[model samples]
Target chain A: MTNSEIMTIHQALFIVMALAVLGSAIFVVTTSNLFRAALMLILTFFGIAGLFVLLDIGLFAVAQVLIYIGAISILIIFAVMLTRGMQGMVPRNSQAVAAAVTAGIIFAVLLLLFGPFRVTVDVARWPVFSLFAGNASPRDVGGIAWTPPNQPIPAMPETYIADFGRSLVDGNQYLLPFLLIAFLVDVVLAGAIFIARQRRPAEIIEDRRRQAEEAAEEAEAMRQAGMTPDVAPLPEGAVASTAEH
Target chain B: MDLINDLLKIIGDFIAGIINSIFGFSPFLADLVTMGLAAVMLCTFAALSFMGLTYVERKVVARIQDRVGPNQAGPFGLLQPIADGIKMFTKEDTTPATADRWVYNLAPLVIAVFALTTYAVLPFAPGVVGTNLNVGVFYIIAMGSGSIVAIIMAGWGSNNKYALLGAFRTVAQLVGYEVPMLLNVLPVVMITGSLSLVDIINQQTTLNGNPGIPFIVFFPFSALVFLISGIAETGRSPFDLLEAESEIVAGFHVEYSGMKFALFFLGEYVNALAVAFVFSTLFLGGYAGPVLPPYIWLMLKAAVVFFIFMWLRGTLPRVRVDQMHNLNWKFFVPVSIVHLVVVMALMKLFVTSPALAQANGGVLVTPGAQAAILFVASLLILIGSLAVVARRARILRLQEAAVLEQRRAENIAAVSA
Candidate 1:
């Protein structure tokens, strides 16, 4: 494609992606059900990944997917189920509304401040087309582009080797923060445990009792129907050894 | 439209030229670049292979206790992990039957991904970083917390008592240590005056007349806090209640096996390596040492720290869960904050203050006199604090022993009656 045509395609992609991102973000905030909100948030992440792609940060796009879609989205859904707060009829909480409004105002302020300056879209006209041609995967573009000018682009072999060597000892630059983040992960883990432990014992007991009653009722209904109750196996080492037998 | 096209062409041509000129005409250069890209690809794929960590732990623990771990596998247990991998993949990957599958699956992957991705921003060698983010330090801290959600999910989703309990403990430990770790880093940041990893290293690159004052020596108390917190953060021995195998089993990864389990394992080792890497870089002056390639020195530094981790694992028993929390909240947190303040003040006085720099033989090549003075004062402070703590502890122990003796006498009297 000619440079102008490439530019147009890029611009179109960005606009579409941006709109999708905005729409998903809106849905994420506006959805009455927490589960649906979490789903919408996933969509928003995907949209942001697209924007990263548009910015020629393919590495970042993949990372966004690897971390957000692969990890964070799952986390949100897990949290929803654990609290069981996402269940039942959709109630629009005033707090959620306030949060949405606050977010909207901040977004509006940001747009007013930075939206006037146009983003340059010439990056699309680069030999990015060649990158996609001949079955060249998106993952290869980073290493081939690292060399000095006028060299033939190298073809990286398919080796799933991550470089942990240079990050530590590269004298000109250090990977201190990367290392520190690992510690931070530990700290965050500690904090999460502390918070989870704060749940009152009474609340826990009540929740368990309610769940047990529901299970017994389900089993009784199945017996009346002249059918074996299809129950999941009990976890190992528990008083509920009936499932094992 | 023509003018815009002309501008675009100029920019495009300039970029293309830069790319071409740098690469040269050699396919070898292309091969090298491809190799670099391949390394990143490996990291992504290796992230998937992180499940081996669990297998490794199982086997290692077994061997340590005079038993073969997973010996039933393909050969002296080499292919045991592979077998386990297949088992996990084929077995019904149930979502606790009633648990949150999305979060359940996502938690392991999240932990694995964040653990791996942090490597991207690290400078592997000079000019060899995956992404060289400007705010590398802050980004690491912010993104590091992203994994908390995943661990929480695992705990809540498993719908099992043990799983939930383990997850709760893991999260608490992770969060509690974060404050001290960040606070410990502040002094280094103060000395460097930038959160960029490159800038921090640059500040400490010299020995006699190199990068400046090794930030560690400049702020020894900060270094100690960073070291102490770093150890706590890794959940190593004396702090590793998270996965206390005898107690919590595998903790958050208790139910995980195969590739899923591997991700958690890899996350852990990678985390261990990453933590050691940071500790070495910040306090040991990164890759800066005499008579060695910078990268080699950096690795050696990290290796030393990693060995220390292993040594602690081997030598020290795990602290009780309550003690772990108390240590972080009661001791490390306050100490870290104070260290940051003290070091910041020191940096301001030494590096930034022109008069102080002049008195100490200039900023870059300051005499040992200033450092020696700071060292002596710190030594005195440390000794005083140690003395106070020892004295208090001795009195408390004596009082506790007396109380214990009284209780023993009461027990004997009851038995006689």
Candidate 2:
């Protein structure tokens, strides 16, 4: 960090990206427009990816972009659009203070846990993460040797991704959580399809007939009121425009 | 090996010398100037190539459709792209009355920036690249994916139904095809055991002085899937559901005009070029050929791949939206996943050890034998998947026929009554 210049390039980039991430995060929540919020969420994701790049972990940086910005944000935008009555003015609520306080608390917790300040409160416990071991010796995590506390963290090996990949399918290491996540995704997809399942032909016919009767009744009411009874369902196969603008 | 022989390296060193010695600047200042110069060079290269690519595409597509393309411009349309650029630059830039101003203005720039960022990790030749990030391939994919956000922004900002619909299809197309695209890339990464493009290229043949088999010979199916998915990713024909001119009327960019619209065009061609370069690097042994400079070889390879892209665009008709989704989900995604898994498993089994592979010599089987085995494996998987696809088609045809027959019977009965 020490340099004759005002700041090192890495420090400058880190500050810029951190500000971007934080600013976009606040904008995402504070903005009333759901679409704009989704876009801002993408910027937040991108800035976090920038932070990961600054940390020189290209894998996490790309993963952040690939998964969060690529997939999740798109999904969020889709949800925002598909739900009716959302694109209009969203009423402002009185929860800004609560949200800010909660966010600050989470940020503080994250900083204490794994921030770049390098002052992790539970650094020793994080490797094997055992409370019952009585601090005798640190157990290695996935066969990776643990660095003792109060020394600089060693540079990660080049093949860390390969090691991580191997552990995902290994007999012991992340196989359980990985499988659980896969199963959860499977269930979620199935649940989504079930929720959006089409109605049966009989149900559709009954609904159409009921709508026709309702329209006829409305027409009669309009006629009794001495106005033209022009209100009726449009022809089938017509699209109802739901454009936001 | 020396700067004198490597033209790019020499030019780079010259820039550094001028910045450091001639200017007597601090190291940091010199570095900054060097970076600025490099960025300028890369941008100039990108802009020129983009112009050239647009001209080439029109000419090729025009010839494909039996038309003389752009002959009215300078020297058989050599300067047509420049003319087109001027036209685009001068075109009236109009904003929708109710459009989201900032998002509308920024989307094109963002997409263009994202597209340009992909070149940073691409290796043009040995020791000649923007940055050569360790996770180069992944980084490129991530950068390319950022365009989805720009596209979404364009759609939402336009305040037009067509634009919004285009954005919707973008999500369906890009997100769906990305699975197969990543899976297609997995075989190359698994074979090389590296995400770095240079490493992948070196793994193909050019590692050390020995010439080896290009990965395409080993994973031809992966190459095919990658090209198809790459085209889908680029929003080109047969998978261009995002635009679907007949339906969405130019899709997300319907409202864009002038240079802003041209930026989207730039993003597209740049993306297509990136995909081609990536394909050549992944499969065609980038910069690894006999009797040519490495970057020239890489360019030739990329040009061939790019021509294939143009050829496919000329030959194929846009698929129906349902067909696009079906092709991605029911066919490409599952097939690519299986292909990746099989390749990974077989490669793992055949290669003796990572330590041996790393040593660059020891292996249970020679590279030739491994390539043969991989080729056979890929052929088997390809054939099996195609057969399954055929069976599915037959079943769907029968089901469709049954429905048509039932409808006909109902109609006949009603008429008789």
Q: Choose the strongest candidate by TM-score.
A: 2
Which pairs clash in model 2? Answer: none
Candidate 2 lDDT tens digits, A68-166: 999899888878777734233433435767877898897875553344443323536464344422354334212223344665446678888888789
**Per-candidate DockQ vs. reference:** 0.03, 0.40
lDDT of 2 by residue, B304-369 (tens): 999999998899999998898888888988888788888877787677455766765545766677
Kindly give the stretch of ten consecutive residues in candidate 1 chain A with the minimal lDDT sum: A156-165
Consecutive 10-residue window with the lowest summed lDDT within model 2 chain B: B1-10
lDDT per residue (tens digit) for residues A133-243 in model 1: 224442223222323356433543222112233545555555777667778998998898776555465655555566677778888888999999889433333422332
The DockQ leader among the candidates is 2
* lDDT by residue for model 1 (B248-296), tens: 7767667765567656666677777777777777777775666655666
Off by over 4 Å in 1: A1-245, B1-94, B211-213, B246-249, B352-367, B377-386
Error of 2 at B152 (Å): 0.5
Candidate 1 chain B lDDT trough over 10 residues, lowest sum: B1-10
TM per candidate comes to 0.61, 0.83
